[model samples]
Target: MFKRLILVLLFLALVFGGIGYWKYRQFQQMTAQLTAPRPPATIASVEAKRESWQPTLRSVGSLVAANGIAVTNEVAGIVQEITFESGQRVEEGAVLLRFEDSVERATLESLRADRQLAQAQYKRAAELIPKQAVSKSEFDIAKATFDAAQARVAEQEAVIRKKTVRAPFSGLLGIRQVDTGEFLQVGTPIVELQALNPLYVDYALPERNFRELAVGQEVQLRMDAYPGEAFSGRVSAIDARVDEGTRSISVRATVPNPDGRLRPGMFAEVQTLLPQRDDVVSVPRTAISYNTYGDFAYVIAKGENDALTVQRRQVTTGRVREGWVEIMKGLDAGETVVRAGLVKLRDGQPVTIDNSVELKDAEVGKQ
Candidate 1:
């Protein structure tokens, strides 16, 4: 019986061993499949070339109207008529609002009638005094009364004019603040008026760039509201004082907005062209990969059998213009760089260049 038990045990061990060996063999085959060399990755690439690069300084800015204000009432009165509609274009001296002026007009008329009577009395007194038909004291008193009456009439007319509100300048009007028959107090807000033809952009730059900044420097502006559209302008003004807290200088540029598409208080991305740099190596912006450690780009290297391989190369980048970036270091003028398909790229990976489409240097400046 013991001999039979030993035989059964040996048979069980042999079966289990075979199953384990089969499993081990399967794992080795799987590992070999995973470790095998992958096929060459197809990618688009561009040759790094030395070209004249226009250095640019980028900053954030805001759009403002060339002339903007909140229209307000100078004198208090009940609004009898709203002469202008909301969002209407208005010219300087255009009547915008009219107040109740009936009482003031009546007062003016009464004062004018009194003044007419006083003038006649003064004329008669002057003639009589010259002929000794009236006393000098009586002539003097009549003249003073005539002058006072004229002054009162002028005052009444001035009061009547104050009841009407006119546009101070030509601009687009905002929403009306007060309705007809609504009484408004002095200095009450009426509407917003803004000159929208030439908009102003206010931006700040680092103090180190003060030397490069100046009036009349060319500026390109991009607003989120208008995608893929670039508005051009020149630097209009530079603030005299530098911000102490941020150590940046404030700048203002004037941009033409003939169609009134740009609005005040809109955020903008500002790019101020500094000066052109000659003989600088540049490549397509897509060739660069940024990470926390640093920036890098994949360079295509030629190998045996005319095979292509990508070598990971670290690069120091500088000013970016249009869709291209300046390579300040770690690259040469004639090296080919992978422009697309960087996500799947690895160091020393084999690559197949499908250079059917390549970026030209001329396209950089067009941006």
Candidate 2:
């Protein structure tokens, strides 16, 4: 019975060992399948084409009113009436506000009557002096009296006109600070006026960039309020003095605001057009990868057996504007560049082209 038990145990052990060996073989086969190499990463690409791209320098700026003035009251009096509404369009010499002018009007009328009397007296004094009917001293005293009265009348009339405020220029008025019956002191601010038909944009650029900028150069403007809308203008002025503190120079441009949508203090971006090249080699910005050593782009070279090999070409860059960049050296216009999946690229790695997705410009301005 013991011998029979030993044989049975040995048979059971052999069966279990066989099962373990079969499982181990299956695991090894599965491991080998999992470890098999994957196909090399395929990338989408675009053929490079030669195109005309103007060189441009882009900078940030802000919109300002062409003419800005603070309106103030010249006389000390209670506000009687405000002729202009806040933000109302006014013409030059239009009545803007009126002070309490009852006393001034009365004084002006009294002065006018006195002035007429003085005119009659002066005429009689001249006739008497010519005829020698009156003494010279008497005629002189009469003339002096008439002149004094005329001066008084002129002063009173000037004072009366000061009570009413008139618009200095044609523009839109800002908020009103004084209401009717409110007494305002002299030089107190009443409102603000701004002319907005032709808006001014002011930007500061570094002194190094001043050499390329000049008056009458064409510029494109982009505002934070209006996305995708590029306003065009020409540079109107450039500051003669560079700011000593910041080493920058101020630039001003005039943009046509026919729609009157642009307002003062709106932040803007300004792009000045530099010199353009007649024929230049350029490529899409995505084709080039920048490293600490240099900027390099991938160019496909025809290999044996219809295989395309990527060659890394070192390039020098110039003014990059819009979506394209100018390649100053080491590249031809018609070469093909790998657009996507460049991260895993090497000097001589074999690549398969499966260009299904086209790469486009992805630059969006951030505030």
Question: Which pairs clash in model 1?
Answer: none
Q: Per-residue lDDT tens digits of candidate 2, residues 33-150?
A: 9887444546566676666667777789988888878998778999988898998889989998889889888988888888788788878988988889888998888788888888
Off by over 4 Å in 1: 1-46, 121-147, 284-316, 335-367
Query: How accurate locally, in lDDT, is each candidate?
Result: 0.90, 0.82
TM-score leader: 2
Give the local distance difference test score of model 2. 0.82
Residue range 1-367, candidate 1, lDDT tens digits: 9999999999999999999999999999999999998779878888999998778889999999989999888778999999999999999999999999988898898999999999999999998997999999999999999999999998888888889999989999999999999999999999999999899999999999999997999999998898999999999999999999999999999999999999999999999988778989999887888667588888999888878999988899987778888999999999999987665678888998786745444422211
The per-candidate count of clashes, in order, stands at 0, 0
The TM-score values for the models, in the order shown, are 0.70, 0.79
